[model samples]
Target chain A: MTPKKVIIADKMNQFSDHWNPRVIGELNGQQVRAVKLKGEFVWHDHDHEDELFLVIKGILKMEFRDRTETIYPGEFIIVPRKTEHRPVADEEVELLLFEPASTVNTGNVVDERTRTTLQKI
Target chain B: MTPKKVIIADKMNQFSDHWNPRVIGELNGQQVRAVKLKGEFVWHDHDHEDELFLVIKGILKMEFRDRTETIYPGEFIIVPRKTEHRPVADEEVELLLFEPASTVNTGNVVDERTRTTLQKI
Candidate 1:
């Protein structure tokens, strides 16, 4: 098997599109993805999957029904399964997402922003 | 449910022992752990699981049978299952480990340095 060492900064430079996640590495059944987030995302919930978001660059605001959490660089937030949440960013934010291989970007609601097939960077 | 957002740096500060892993968060079946590594570790292989090592504070050298990979902060390496590898750090190094809940720190080796029960910080 080939060796896999991912330089997070190098992978972030591979893509410039916002909200599109590019797979960086995979361990067990989970996929490690890097995404650029700007503006706001739709409110959705993953019925059976939990998503972990680790901020690498800018600030990320995860808005829930009751409250909002601000995640800075070197910080991570996990959105539990079946919980409705929306992610927003005032500026461009680089994030590393850890989730299962079967996760969809839009979760329960799949529209134009939904990315079913994620590209590996 | 309560919000779970982990500040990697803060969680890392809670531990001081080298080679011992502290759990930070859990997603799906995998547990995200933080460990401080110094000196040389035992050469072992996970026969049934793959482990991801993400450098957080210092340089970490992963020595394999064929070659050695140096992982710096903001970088990560994935050691495939059944691959013989040993980790070493010249000075104090902080690392974030991503692996299954049942994964043992020493892998196939059960030595005194092995941490069977990882504490959560």
Candidate 2:
């Protein structure tokens, strides 16, 4: 691929929907995606891949079956494979996520929020 | 792992030095590291894996053998494996890097700017 810069904010503005992610780049067989989030997300887990959350704007509250954590801008969290979790936000949030190309944002479960058209940036 | 926040600013403050990266998390055997950069970095490349550079703040200009691109705070770039490149910044910039845990920041070529102890955040 050509040597190019992936302008994040510019990429984010290309789409106006929430939950649906836009694929920005990939390396080592893994994909990097950016998504806009709101309210709460479905609780689920990927049986074979971990989920990485890099908060870009606003605050993200990701909760597991027992405990929960808040991820702010410049902060990141890794939800290992097979670990169930739900991501929530009291307000709107923007984020960058890293995981296998096939990973469903909603994990093993499916819902209206489980989007698959996330194109590579 | 417990559900907890990885406050990047707090983590960044934990270290007062420069060049060295702090590992915040990892998934699927790849590590996620954060580093502060200014001026320029040694020209180098990893022979085995691609290099990912995500600009968190300020601007990043990466020059390759043929072309160069500017990556801003919301942008990212992936330098394919074995692609020689140099990172330059007119001012200080904060960034996040994703590569194999064993991949050195300076690629295969070592220099004074290379850092080895980037601990896990």
Candidate 3:
């Protein structure tokens, strides 16, 4: 199969809902996803998956037990596995997330915000 | 340990060399790297690893054995394993690469352009 190019901005325009992630590309058992965030997320941790969040638009505030990190556009942060954390956005934020294909959006927490199945863009 | 934010532009400004990639962040046995590319690269293919290339600045022309793909800023392409591909740039291109930690820059070809040991920025 031929590999295709994925335009991140175009993919972001496809979805308007907040907190839902859409898979854009995949490679080597890892998936690249585009997600929109408007408010706050649940505090949780993945037992075996590491999450990388790259801010595409606006800002992202990652709150951990010890500290909170403010990530801006053109910046990224990696949250290691088994570390409790939360992501909060003051305004609408666009992000690209990289993680294992088996990762769930809510990590260990199974709440209304949990997304076990993601749509591919 | 607290996870720190990595500024993509700041890391890009640290190195000026072309074709050499520097590791920026690592997670789940995968490495996120920043590299500068110009001219043409050798045709090579990783036997067991897939590579993802995200264009940060300029444009990248990925030449496959059957077709070619032009990736632009805010766009990305994934080269699957065992696929013969070469990346060419008419001008200088800055990129973010996500791949397995064991992946080599030159894949199966060992030449002067091959980089086995990479520096972390």
Candidate 4:
């Protein structure tokens, strides 16, 4: 395979949709995805996979069952498996997400916000 | 465990050694490490692990057998397993590396620069 670099900022400009993650790269059964977030996401939890959220731009407020954590740009948070959490952003936030291939966006609870098929950007 | 966010910039400030990777986080047997790069790295290839290099600051050039890929800030490149490559940087570059926990920096060729024990930041 030809070695190619994935430019995150260029990928972020390809789409303007919120909460939908675009596949950027994959390795070791894990995938690196980019997502644009605004407003609030559904309260959910991945029972079998852990999710790593890296804020590329803007601030991200992750609300959990007990407390809320503010993730700034250049910061990352690892949401353990089976931990119910919600991600909220006041403005458009660009982020990179890392998780296994079988991980579902909405976790066990399937909703309209769940993205079953992710597009590669 | 208290949920804590890993700030990439803050972690980058904790060390100044070049080519030595410091563990930042781990998930599913894979580790997220931060490395400061300058000059050129040795030509090596991991036999069983694929390495992902995300340029957090400055520029990185990965030289392969056939080509050289330029990875800029906010860009990432995945060096496939068994692919002989060397990373070169003109100046100090901050990068985030993702790979299996057992992955060695020197790949198949063991040298004095090879670090057996990695420090956690």
Task: Select the stronger candidate by lDDT from 3 and 4.
Answer: 3
| lDDT of every predicted structure (CA atoms) | 0.92, 0.83, 0.96, 0.91
Model 2's DockQ?
A: 0.69
Each prediction's TM-score versus the true structure: 0.98, 0.90, 0.98, 0.97
Candidate 1 C-alpha lDDT tens digits along A1-121: 5475789999999889998999999989899999999999999999999999999999999999998999999999989899999999999999999999999999999888999999987
* Model 3 regions lying over 4 Å from their true place: none
iRMSD (Å), candidate 4: 1.1
For all the predictions, what are the DockQ values?
0.78, 0.69, 0.88, 0.75
Better of 1 and 4 by TM-score: 1
Which segments of model 4 are wrong by more than 4 Å? none
Residue A89 in candidate 4 has what lDDT?
A: 96
Model 2 pairs in collision: A6-B75, A8-B74, A8-B75, A23-A120, A23-A121, A24-A121, B23-B121
What is the C-alpha lDDT profile of model 4 across B1-121, one tens digit per residue? Answer: 5378998989999999898999999887889999999999999999999899999999999999888999898889998898999999999999999999999899998887898789987
In order, what are the TM-scores of chain A for the candidates?
Answer: 0.97, 0.94, 0.97, 0.96
Between candidates 1 and 3, the one scoring higher on DockQ is: 3
Interface RMS for model 1: 1.2
Compared with the true structure, what per-residue lDDT tens digits does model 3 show for residues A37-113? 99989999999999999999999999999999999989999999999999999999999999999999999999998
Candidate 2 local lDDT, A1-121, one digit each (tens)? 5667777788878886788888888888788889988998888999999888989899999998888898888888888898889889899899988988888787788888877667765
lDDT of 4 at A118: 95
